[model samples]
Target chain A: MNNRLKILRAERDWSQATLAVHLDVSRQAVNAIETGKHDPSLPLAFRIARLFDLSIEEIFHDQN
Target chain B: MTKIDATHNLSESAPSSVLRKVLITIIGGLTAVFSIAFLAGYTVAVTEQGGLNAYAIGTIAAGLGLIGLTVFISYKLWPKGTHEAVPAREKKSQHILWAAVVIGVLLGGYMAVASGDNPDGVFSNEPVTASFAVISIATWLIIVPIITWMWWRTIDEHEADAYREGALVSAHVYIFLAPTWWMAARAGWAPQQDPMIVLVIVSIVWSIVWLYRKYA
Candidate 1:
């Protein structure tokens, strides 16, 4: 899944570490998601969406 | 946005996914081997050894301790699914794992040799002795510093973490092996003449397999 995570994080002026802390995950996880190296689990996707106060669909779009 | 673009993106992301999949496969394989050996040793020792109660208790305690440690590390170090990739952190994590493996082998070898002779002969009734107990305790002490060093070196102020979780998993495996090692040593499986030649062989094979899987 390609996400605007980097852009969103930048807009919020938050580092990956800050976002990771907020999500209760490791910074590497955030990095993985941002670089499209790893896709987030459903729970984590929900958490990320909730953290940014956006719908999951808005944050993560299915390519297929 | 387009199918072509999506495919391109996926292709671009393939390498890390491949790496993660390979890692998972290797870990799963190791877990299987360790589990089989542990169970076999436990069964053999319980049936063959005299102190069934002590063996059972020791195995359970060691297993639980290892499981707890694995869980703690995983929760602390593993990425939660969103962090950006940091190559440096990944390298550090690999280094920590290598260090742990080296330390574990060294300590195991030391304990195997150090406790070869029954020094005090206190537990003569039992298979093991005061010397074996001392060695086991000493091995635990050595393991602590090695584990701590791995944690300290792998974790960073900014990198997205997933190593602690991985370490925790590794710890659980180690824990499961600890009792078997102790019991085997006590059983004189590692005699002065042969001295756990099988374990040494297995350890060498394990290392080779791990390296092949990881790098080859």
Candidate 2:
């Protein structure tokens, strides 16, 4: 999975820690997702999308 | 730059994702070394004593030492930036540490009875063979269930998948410690020497194998 989490977070001027707090996850988790090292679960994906007020497809795209 | 903006800038420069692998490796390495040293010392002491009692003390000491080392390392390596990315599995790791402590204390108490060598206490010198037996049974029952519950509750599907992949790469170095600990206690390989030596050898061998695979 590839995500624009970095770009989106950058635009919002939110630190990973701050974003993680909003998402109720550890900062490491947010980093993993942003770097494409990890893919969030459906629930977490929805949470992220909701936080950014964007559709899931806007933040995450299928690499395949 | 404003402090809030500075925080954002720092977050962008080096994201939290990069640190997970590094932290796991460091922690795994530390755990491996600590297990080996403590087990070796324990085995030697047990061999001289010629009983299960010595083995118990050695195990307890090693468990305590590892906990101390973990705390020290965490304090020293306190990473910069927010730590929001911590996986839920980290909670299981913490619980495991507490479980280890509980096991150590219970075992130590049992050993004190088995050896009839209580240094200072009202029960000192009292024959506690039955008490030791009962306690040992109880401890085993409690520890296993607690570990199972913790694993089930804390490890999500994703973390479990990651663990499986990482375990293969590390040649199961991290997983071997628990089994080795159990074997040392249950196996009657050498009654006099602490069986923890077995754990030490296992950790060393695993470490070597992990390094070989990693570097080669």
True contacts kept of each: 0.00, 0.29
lDDT of 2 by residue, A1-64 (tens): 8999987887777887677668866455666687776788999899889998999999999987
**Per-prediction TM-score to the true structure, in the order listed:** 0.34, 0.49
Deviation in Å, model 2, residue B90 alpha carbon:
6.6
In model 2, what is the error at residue B80, expressed in angstroms? 8.7
Fnat for candidate 1 (0 to 1):
0.00
Error of 2 at B211 (Å): 15
Taking every candidate in turn, the Cα RMSD to the unseen true structure, in Å, is: 16.7, 10.3
Q: What is the lDDT for B98 in model 2?
A: 59
Per-residue error (Å), model 1, residue A29: 0.7
Highest-TM-score candidate: 2
Off by over 4 Å in 2: B1-5, B8-137, B155-158, B166-216
Measured by lDDT, the strongest candidate is 2
lDDT minimum window of 10 residues, candidate 2 chain B: B116-125
Shift of residue B99 alpha carbon in model 1, Å: 14
